[model samples]
Target: MLQNPIGISRLVLASSSPRRRELVASLDLSLPVSVLSPDVDESVLPAWTPDETVRQLSAAKAQAALELLKGRSGAEGDELLALDAVIIAADTVVALDGEVLGKPLDEKDAAAMLMKLQGKRHEVYTGIAVLQSGNGQMHVESKKTIVTMKPFTEEKARKYAATGEPLDKAGAYGIQGLGATLVEEIEGCYFNVVGLPLSLLADMLEPYGIQAI
Candidate 1:
């Protein structure tokens, strides 16, 4: 359709996360984009497993964006989502023993998470959902990665926590930034740990429209 590298005419990102926005923009898309802040409940139910939590959260985001765009689809020059239904959303969770570790609530929490993860291996799970708007159908995929952190003492944890990098990231760490220093190894899709799981996203979106070069 468009000359953009992504061949997309319109892409609406249903997230306010800068990381997700940057990941999508890196695709060199030629379409206009709108970020809809998904203000929904992200609380996990006690019985829901880690995989279920991520899937539900991502689906919730995509559905919310689709509903938000419905009002704008009919107006003149107000095409919000692409006519092809290109909506992308994702959720990532760091899990250990089936306990999902989301963004830390505060520095204390962040430090505790880091301490628990020191010289330990854990799993990072990211759930991605892409929808085609025409028939109200979408495809979804999930990726799980194993990441091991190097041993770090309490002093290091507190110091790292002070940087504020871990405050907004799952597992109280970021694999793409300074937090990488904390990781000794990873055994899966690198992007999954970063939050988007790009390969899985591409696969899920392909049936509807997206593919990697």
Candidate 2:
């Protein structure tokens, strides 16, 4: 038989992002780990710096999951318990010229963001937080990667955006999906551009006694 030394009975992931979930799943954690999406207000805070934004949002997500565990029911028992938890949360953003490029409001907005990014350089930031409620140990950090997109005609941009993939993605693009063709090169963590910096996430989680298989 195999074993894990993380001293964790379950790992909780608190985000609705499919990308994050997939990245965490790749860890091949023990089958007892549970994934949960916490409801959080994602609106950007006024005057909040980019680095702080990622940290705050991730911490908030962890806090939300903590509260949920404090109040919600579990299959084991009717009453709430700490459940030896190690919760993970993260957020990603794309920015250019100090302006945060959130999910495009519409096709027009997507096109506008793409225009500024095509043939130009922009940064992708991901904030990660790991909290162990059973012992109150917490770790939080952020990672950045710069991605450059190849120049293309408006017709090409329009065609890609029409697939509806850009609308849900930050900076109006996803380097991991159909958007891969647009990437000329990247200067940092490739997984960060994919929406989760796996190596960095591993480094952060290591201190908390959790090891991804």
Candidate 3:
């Protein structure tokens, strides 16, 4: 078989986020994709900005998955390592007034987060890390989108939260699903707000001789 230069035999997503998985699939790339859940601490570091926090978290996940792949294949030879699959990892967060808002714990928490986001503009930051396996050549980037939510009452927030969709999403909302009705306007990459930025992914993959189109 002809060897691909980057040595990536397949694509792996080092995330358990169903949204991310769905987004990547939407790219319609005709390559083998596998999902690996990386066990990395996601606690934000003290004094790190929202962008930095997500970037660090994404990189951590990617590197952890890469190391695990290396260990699994035991492909210590540089050439052998280069020929492994590429791992893509990402982390997303919603930030308002410099405070990061992660997934809500329960209905109450989701309602509270939605209430805070209502009638306000918030930043959605998604950090992505893509790496070639074996040699571990990697690319990391963060994309931000400004989302303005329509003014709504706490009662509305509670009603939406009760549906249980917001409970598992950062900032108590998922822009791509039922939560779309809550968004008033978005100022950046829509896909970034959805979780994985397709344009960014294309750019990141291009240098490695991969194409999403």
Per-candidate local distance difference test: 0.80, 0.80, 0.86
Better of 2 and 3 by lDDT: 3
lDDT of 3 by residue, 1-213 (tens): 212355456788998889889888988888778788878988877799999988999999999998777665665554443356788999999999999999999999999999999999999999999877756667789999999999999899999999999988899998888899999999999999988999998888777668877
Inter-residue clash pairs, candidate 2: none
Error of model 1, residue 150, in angstroms:
0.8
Candidate 3's displacement at residue 23, Å, is 1.4
Give candidate 2's error at residue 119 in angstroms.
1.1
Tens digit of lDDT per residue, candidate 1, span 1-213?
A: 222223446667888889988887876655667777767789889998888888989988888888777766765555535365578888999998788999999989999999989998999999887766545566667889999999989999988999999999998998898899999999989988988877676566555445555
After superposition, the stretches of candidate 1 with alpha carbons farther than 4 Å from their true spots are 1-8, 72-83
Rank list by TM-score: 3, 1, 2
Error of 1 at 196 (Å): 0.8
lDDT of 1 at 20: 87
| lDDT score of residue 105 within candidate 3 | 95
TM accuracy, model 3: 0.91
Worst 10 residues of 2 by lDDT: 1-10
